[model samples]
Every structure is written in C-alpha cells, then in structure tokens.
Target chain A: MKDWEKNIRIVEPYVPGEQPNFPEMIKLNTNENPYPPSPRVQKAKEELSIDILRLYPDPTSNLLVEELANYYGRKKEQVFVGVGSDDVLSVAFLTFLNSKKPILFPDITYSFYSVWADLYRIPYERPAVDENFQINKEDYYKENGGIIFANPNAPTSISVDLEFIEDILEHNQDVIVIVDEAYIDFGGISANSLIDRYENLLVVQTFSKSRSMAGMRIGFAMGNERLIKAMNDVKYSINSYTMNQPSLYLGVEAIKDEDYFRENINKIIFTRENTKNSLEKLGFDVLDSKTNFLFISHSQYKAEDIFAELRENKIFVRHFNLPRISNYLRVTVGTDAEMECFIRSIEEFLLKRA
Target chain B: MKDWEKNIRIVEPYVPGEQPNFPEMIKLNTNENPYPPSPRVQKAKEELSIDILRLYPDPTSNLLVEELANYYGRKKEQVFVGVGSDDVLSVAFLTFLNSKKPILFPDITYSFYSVWADLYRIPYERPAVDENFQINKEDYYKENGGIIFANPNAPTSISVDLEFIEDILEHNQDVIVIVDEAYIDFGGISANSLIDRYENLLVVQTFSKSRSMAGMRIGFAMGNERLIKAMNDVKYSINSYTMNQPSLYLGVEAIKDEDYFRENINKIIFTRENTKNSLEKLGFDVLDSKTNFLFISHSQYKAEDIFAELRENKIFVRHFNLPRISNYLRVTVGTDAEMECFIRSIEEFLLKRA
Candidate 1:
C-alpha cells in the first residue's frame, strides 16, 4: 500500500521446522544429525584466530572445492560453494529458469521450490509423482526451463535412482536437471558420479545431514563446468563473500574427516532401522525411510491428534498442515536414547487415543 | 548467450576490497580493522560445541535483534540483521526500488552501489558530490525512491552532518533514505538518533569496522518498524537464515564489549591522525581523515605509479582507476610498526624515482 514496490507478494514464505530448545524434552522436529560434526571441526575452531577474522573468505572457496572435487572425482570448476544448500538451489532457479521456459518440479516435494519460482517471476509446473511417491522419469522428456527435486523426497522418503536421473538427462539435453542430494549420504546414490557424463545435471548436497555442519551454513553443488559457471555468474551478482572465513575453515575440516562422516551416518542408519521396526510393530504404517527421518501415520488415530498428544508429553514431531500431507507426521530420527524416549512417548499418546 | 536471459554476460562485476591473507605486505589495501576483535569473540568460539553445528540457525535471528535494539535504544522491530552490510544493501535495492522510481546515490561513493543498481535493473541517478568530495545535502532533496551512501563516504573520508540528513527526511516523507554508517563509530555521529523522528530514515551499520568482525559477516539496519518490516519481508523471501550461528554470537559479544570497541577506535583515530600528519609533511595532500584510513597523494608522483612502486617493494595501498579519484591512494591506517615501514618504503621509492 505504501510507495515501495517489492516483488509480487504471491510467495507463502518457507517456514523452517521448529527449533524448541526446551529443557529436558526429547526433540526430533528437524532432521539434524544426532552426533557432532567431525572432531576436526573443533580442531579448526581451536586454530581459528581473532586476528584472522579480519580477512574475507576466498570467493571461490578453493580449498573446500578441491576436497569436494577429489571426493567426486571431478574438476574444481564442477563445484560451486554457497552459504547453504537452500542458497545453492535458489541460485540454480535463476541460472537455469528463464521467462522463455517454465520450471518443472515435483508437486508434493519441497515447498520452497514454488516460493523461489514465484520470487523470480518465472512460470513453473508441478509434474506429479507416482502413487509410491517416486519420480517418473518419462514425464520429463519435454522442453523445460529446469527440473529439480529432493532425493529421498521430503515428508515422503522416496528416492530416485542416479541411473534414472541419467536417463532423464540423456533424453532432455536442453534443460538443466538439478538432483538435490541433501540426504544422499544416508542411502541414495548421488548424481555426482553422472555429472561428468551429463552436462545438464547439477547435484546439490549439504554438510547439514552427514557432516553435521548445518548451523555453520555452507552448501555446495557439483555439475559440469558450464552449468556451475552459469550459477557462479548469478552468485557474483549477489553476495560475493557468501561463506564467511570461520565457516570456510570449518567446511574444509568437515570434508577432510571422512571417518567421522562415515561413523555418524552409519549410526543414524542403524538407529533409523531400529526406530522403523519399533514403529511398525506398534501398528503404525511407517514408510521405509532411507533418510534420517521417517514419514508415518497411524491407521486409527489421526496424525494431528497424535502430534498434539506427543506435545503434551514434552515430545515434538513435524506435521505439515497441507492438503497432501495433513494426515501424516514426519518424525526425525535422533540419538538412540532420544529415539527410544520418542517412541515410548508416541506409543503412550497413540494407546490413550485408541 | 547460449539460450536465454540478458545483460548477465558482459557484466563487469565490481571486485570486492582485497582480502590479502598471504603474510600481508604492510596490509593497507582494504579497510579492515587493523586490530583484532573483542576477546569475548574468542570466548564465544570456545563456548560453541560441535554438537550444535547439526542444527539450523534461527531464521528470525531474534536474539541478535534484541541485543542490537538494546544497544541502539530502538524497538526490536526497528532493527534488521544481515550477513554483512553488502547483504543488507542488496536487499534494500530489491525491496525499495521499482521500475517507475529512480534510485539515487553519490557518484563517487562505494563502487558496489552501481553494480547492485545494474544487477536489479533499478534505474538510478548518481548526484555528483561537490569538488572537494563533500556530500552537499541540498543535492538529495529531489524526488527519489531510495537514497543511500556510506556516511563518512568511502575512498575519501568526508562526513555529512546528521542534521542535514534529518532535514532531508523531514522534507521527503514517502521516500526511503538509507544512511550507511559503515565507519560511524570511528568519528561521526550515527543517524541512529534521527531514526525516532524520521520514519523514512534507514541507517545501515556493520560489525566490519569498529566491532572488528568483518570475517564473521554481520551487519544491521535501524529504522522505523514499517520500513524494517518491508526489508525483512524481502530478506525472508530471500535467504531466511541470513547470519551464520557463530558469527551471530561473535557480533553479540563484540558489541557488548563497549570498552574494547572504544579502546580500538581510539587507537585507530590516533594512527589516522599520525598518518595524515606524516603524509602532509612529506609533500602529500592528505584528506582530513575521520576514518581509520587516509586518502593521500603527492603532486610529483602519479597515484597509479606510486601504487606500482610500492607493490615492487612489497607494500600495498589501494588506488582506484575511476574518475576524479585517479590521483589519490586510499591507505588504511595500520599498526605503528606497519605505518613506519610504509613511510620508509614510500620514501625509498620516491628517492629512487628522483
């Protein structure tokens, strides 16, 4: 109503999962890693100097890119560093989508996709997934501005295979297909391997899950040099020093400590197995989860009622209030002890409802 | 060039100020705090556990806003935080400027202003500063969308009075006027005082200067509730978690340590005075500095020539190849030993030239 002209305010802003740091609550709302980032992260912190805080971070994030390239068996130009995975994805929308072509993404995946598309004033379409919630590769052969989806898709842990993604890229040469591998370290094979073969494919991954550096806010993408270069062009126009100096050192250190990454992810997978079995035995319909979280609902009790009941017992779980997912509660897997407490609390809540 | 979009190619991006971390050859090129940040920044670093790194940063940045509001005596809604001043400025352009209104700034101020204006396709008029590089307040009374400039303007350290700023705001009721106080703590009064009276004034400041947390990347803006709310809407639609966690804690700690801030600013002012005196005695025309830097040049030596000569002797000072500023070198006031070395090196270079 005032004189200022912002973008078409059609975007329903992405609300992050609640972070209730309540005293002595068994919390599992967001899919944060159950363990610390590598012990190397602490070493990096110890070596950080007040004096070094005067210098800007390397814009290229050269050292982290070097490490990531080695891990993926690709050149440094194939990788682009951003403040977070969400930051990387936003840049991808601008780099890949244009007014000439419409963006294509899953109808039931990350809500942030629509928000970004709207913000850029780019037209977008949502191609539906199969009944099993898996990406149908055949539906994406037409001309598109870009295609993006979360692997082991959010609120529905259905992952698309790297082989299928490559097949899509093979048929659709003109459009960029972004394979978001945010939860890839848990189970799904990353399209990072196919990045050398497919110029149109960009694999976006995060340290938030496997390396456990979410609060530090660093994310990276791997693609062919041309695609990565295009993203860089957009990024340079925005905040150039996106990653601050302390986070730069921490990110490099996190990547270097592969043993810690493996150990922590293995622990989460093991815990997910245990939690999944317990939920199924409790007469809950839990989908097979390859992520650090599970999508599930009870047949008798409504998901909303169960969520409210769990909160009464000082336990938290994520329930999206949308037409597609209002009946399900997506529960993040925490530490072994935290999971056990969460399971017990849920059992009590559901049993009382029954 | 390949398929779509425009003006992205052939963009001569503005190079950020030098980071220069390799043993820093007298390190006066960029305007970083010569001294380290508050010791409490280190304390905050120590207090961080790697376990917390797995979680997302609070998107609202509520705690940092509270501390900033308390520091500035403004309501929480009157404050806004960003990754750095650059992030704040970028959002300002996106939020305030439209296709219909003209953005205005000084022609000879921060070079990034034009870069951003071009990036957003926001039409802007750079009202020329006076001959002595002073900001004439009368020049800004024109009808405009938003007015922004670094107070104690960059390159040349001339400050405009806050009284003049209040007058402009009172007259221009519907428009937004941004006062960038990037260097205010060193000398000039912040337009923060005028925020209560002028609903239109948005004063942007950063921790990069007096707080000494540049590498940590935190900045803030103080304005009326409505103006800040519009800016926040833009920020949230953009990057939600604008500040990284450790940087947020570091900025909070740095601001709370007023004694440390005061001491370092005093030392910087002392060094600036001494450097200006030495430059004047050496037959150089030094601008009266209110910042931790000096704008100086000799009548005999071309600024570009001296810049090259100093680099050969492993010293660095910044010289812009822009209009009306080609003859002067912007030298950051460094440590006493660093300044002595710079003087000796410059004298040697001059003697060799003669």
Candidate 2:
C-alpha cells in the first residue's frame, strides 16, 4: 500500500453481508424482503420519466421527511432522512461522539458501529450485552458519551423491552441515545413513540426491511427537533443532495401504502413462525425471533457444514466469519415457496450427512 | 438545550440558495440546467417498477463504477461514487485532512469547505487567492497538510492554468491534492491529465453538471486505486449503500448517451459566450468565464439594488452576501430563447436604473 494519509492508513474497513453472485442459488442471505414493494412503487417510477434527472433533488429531502413525520405522528422538524440506516447511524456517530467523551454501545450488536467510531477517531466503549444477549439498562445509566444499539439485535434476533429502553433514556439525559430499529417492523414495537418524550434520543429506522425498498436506500431518524437539527447540520455540511429522485418518490409511496405494508408484515410473520417450528422438528434450536430471519443451529449438525451443504445444493444462507455468532446461521424468511424449497433441500443435505 | 455531546453543540447549519415560492418568478437562483435531462432517464425509470424497489441496491455501486472506469480508461478500483460531489468532497475531507498538518484552501472558494472543517473539527488554513481572485500557483506550492479548490472557481468563474496546478502537485509529495471540478465539463482544462502522474491527485466531478443527472444524486472521484480505496473505506464506514438502483440506471444511460450530452453542453457553452459578450457591450465588467455561468458587475450600479430589481422583474440570479463578492452577481446560462428573454429583461432593469 502507498504511504496514504494517516487517517486512511489507520481505518479498518467494514465488510457488508454476503451478496453472493451465484445466479442459480436459492438465496436466503442479506435479510432483504422477499415480497416486492407496494405496486404503487413501480407505478411511481414508471410514471416518473428519466428527464426529471436533469434537476437536482430537493437538498433537504423535505417532502419525504414530512411524509415520514406524518407516518410517525411527529412534527416535520423531528424527522430526518438519509441514504440508509447505516448512513444515519454513521452520521449520528459523527454528530454526537468525539474527543469530549467516549461513546457506548452493546458489544454484540451491529459491527459497523465500531467501524464508524474508528474511522472518525471517536473513543467508544462496548458495554457487553448480558449472557442472553440483552443490553443492560443499568449499565447505560451512568454517563459516557453517546449510546446506540440495534433492536432485536442481529444474529440473535432478541429484542429489549421498550420500557427498559425508556428507563435508560430517562436516566441518561446528558448523552445522545440512538436506537437502531432496522428489523423492528417484522414483528417488534417501534421506539418512535418515545421520540416526543425524549429530546436527546434519536431513533433510526430503515425502509429497507419493512417497506421492501432497500434498493431505494432510504432511512430516517425521529427525535427532538434539536437533535434532528444537529443531524441536519451534519447532513447539509456533507451532502445537501443526499437521496436520489426515484428513491425520494418511492420512499414517499412506500410509506403511504399501509395496506401493502401490513400485508407483507403478516406474510413474513407467518413464514418466520412456521420456519422456526419446522427447524425445531428437525432437531435444530432456533432463537425466539421477532425479525424476518431465524438465528439457528442444529444439535447434531455443524453450522458450517449445513451452511456449506446448502450452498453445494444451490441453497444460499448467511454465515458470519466472526467469533461470537459463527455457530449460528441467519436465514432470511423468504416467500412460502422459497422457504418450502429451502426446508426440503436442508432435509436432503442433513439426511445425506447422516 | 439538553446536555448533549459537545462536538456538535456548537455546530451551525448551512443555508442553501433561496427556493422562493413565488409562482410567477423566472427562477434562476440556483445554477440548475434550464433544460430537462435526456428522455432516456425517464425511459429507464419507467422500465423498472415497484417490484425492483423491494431489493437492496448493490452496496458497491459496481455497475456505475465500472462504467465510469471504462469511460475514463481507469481501473474500476480507482473510482468512488457518492450521493453527490458535496458528499464526495466531505468524505475526502474526512479521509485526507486528518494528516499531521492542516488543510490549505482558498479563503473565498466554496463556502462549504470551512463548514465541513468546523463540523469535523479539522484544523485548516484559508490561503487567500490573488487580488484578481485567481488561485496563485506559488501560494499552493508551499507546505500543506492537503489542498483543494474548485477549478474555474465558483462565483468568480476564473479558470486556473494546468501547469501551475501541476507544479503544486509536484511539490506536495506526502499530501492529497483535490480539484473540485463542479463546473469543469463546461470548459475548464481538466486536471485529470495529471492524475496518472501523481498518486495523491484526485479530480472530483458531478453528474449534476456534465451529465445533467443532478436530480439523481451521483458524483465520483478519479484517483489511483489507493486513494479511491481510502475514500471507499470512509464511505463504507459511514454509509455502505450510497447509491440507489434507479439512479444507477440513470447514470449509466447519461454517460452512454454522449451525443445528447454533447448537444446540450455545446448549447450552454454558446449561450455562455453570447451572454458574456452582451454584458461587456452594456459596459459591465465581466469575469472571464469558462463555465455555464457569468460573473459580472458595473462600477456605477449597486449589486444589491440590481439583484432586487431583477427579482421584482422575475429574473433571479445569485448575489452573494459575502464581502468580496457582494459587488458581483453570478448568473447561470439558460437556453438560447430563455437567455434572449433574460438579457432583454436585464437591459431594461439596468437602463431604468441608469
């Protein structure tokens, strides 16, 4: 490598989830929605011609922000939008965490949080989640710098109760607390309700999971106007023009079609329950999931072997290369048909190994 | 307000140009293209519907990056795309300015540079451009942590020579030097020629100007693989998925359709040349412009009053409130027919005041 800038040389890059290029594989990775976005999304894009591409998108993303505000029942000032939940969290790290104090987060949560901390040179502490992988409310009551964690934490899919989250907010009034609800809408409650009560709390959510618009790269933050104003300041200083025009329209349409979203939620919930039950019947232990995916490991079969066997049979699932979660396979709940195919293939792979 | 993190407590917000609500105003406040983007942009959007919106965008923006590489004859690994050039520049600041030394930029260049410095708490020095507001080649050759400036410099539209820029890069061995070519495709000499010679040289361009895909929110950097990799590391740590799918299609199409781009660019260039000549005829001092806009002022008329008169007559051009530029107005060149109307309106405004 070249003798790069000291900061660039120092940064440790974050690896995103596997986007396998095996065209014929039955992909169950990346936690994308199996169902398509609202029909209105396609209709909106079809209706919006490429010619509008000549003009710059609204620097503020004002329209989508207002629509999101109405969706969450908050004032327009309380809402902010960005490229994705990852982007929102990254900016939040910059806006709230720096030299003045060390930031705090769960040790077993999303891996990108620590990456952002390192990239910005922000000091942060990982208060370990309990043995059951739950963020301890008591651990966060004392002052640090800022706080953030993924709800229904990744790999484990276990959610912390909202009351416990609120208690932490009430106790830690001096710091900025962020709740990342990337997978919340699958079957969990949103902390959006707590926005009006807490001025220092910034709850970030993504359209990628629930709205089935991950391809559009839209995520938002809801909080007291002061915190939002700070994020907006950071956003403007970076890219006044953040969201693309098509995503802007698609995001607005995705939130407006409540019936489509509610239907998709029910479908995923049903599939997740059925899939968990089926895996258990096959001697696998599955985490109690409130997300679109299952955190599972078979007592008789190795997680890596099952992961490999499925891949050999053209059925793709996720396996992290990390230490804590390496024993579990995170399988995204796909359509009923895709899930059926996955189960049958897994049964065959396990039977062959036996 | 609340006891928040101290880093952002003193952060101030940026004010964009006036997006006034007057229904009948001939809007020219921001330097947006007078004409719409190619019909192909709409065609691409219409072709992809709501179904595609459900999926997540390719996290790396692979297709667009490859297309840019092929077009520029550079390695795909050497380019990094972002939501906008503003986003690209911000990432650059985060990646490069953390060097042991502080960044050096023109005092009167893009206003947002200082805002980013303040936001990130980056130490910087504002080296003044020469009396004519031209970037002094010798001034930039001195020691610097990093260096960046908009070529054909904004508001002044005074293009810098290629050799002087080369001289600066020749001297700064350990530092990253950036050329923000926001208005480059209009007519300024590209610093891209020096990119192959210097590993530290980065030339950032936007679809907002040359490609006319401003609304789509795409900008990128052209540098060697190491620098691009560093920028991508910052992007991934901040926001893994910066571009959405539909905007990806728009960018691909915009770059491929060089005929459409050439036709529009030529027209804007012609309009700029004509406008500059006409203003000179009216006894106004006009900066030598190599962009789609003109910067002009008269010795007699007050710049603010002239700006006010134009607004009253429904012809809006940008007039900065800053000290050095308060005397001049920056006007974006429009279509031939639109420019004809604008000149007539301005002629009337100037004569009536005379």
Using DockQ as the measure, which candidate wins? 2
**Relative to the unseen true structure, what is the C-alpha lDDT of residue B55 in candidate 1, on a scale of 0 to 100?**
80
The TM-score of candidate 1 is 0.96
Once superposed on the true structure, which residue ranges of model 2 sit more than 4 Å away at CA?
A1-9, B5-9, B21-24
Candidate 1: fnat, from 0 to 1? 0.48
lDDT of the candidates, in the order given: 0.81, 0.82
TM-score of chain A of each: 0.96, 0.96
Candidate 2: residue B74 lDDT (0-100): 88
- Please give, for residues B237-354, the per-residue lDDT of candidate 1 as tens digits: 7667667788777778888898998999999898888877877887899987777788887899999988888787677889999899999999988888889888888888778888
Clashes of each: 0, 6
Could you tell me how far off, in angstroms, the CA of residue B287 lies in candidate 2 after the best superposition?
1.2
Q: Worst ten-residue run, lDDT, model 2 chain B?
A: B1-10
Error of 2 at B336 (Å): 1.6
In angstroms, give how far residue A206 of model 1 lies from its true place.
Answer: 0.7
Q: Estimate each model's TM-score.
A: 0.96, 0.97
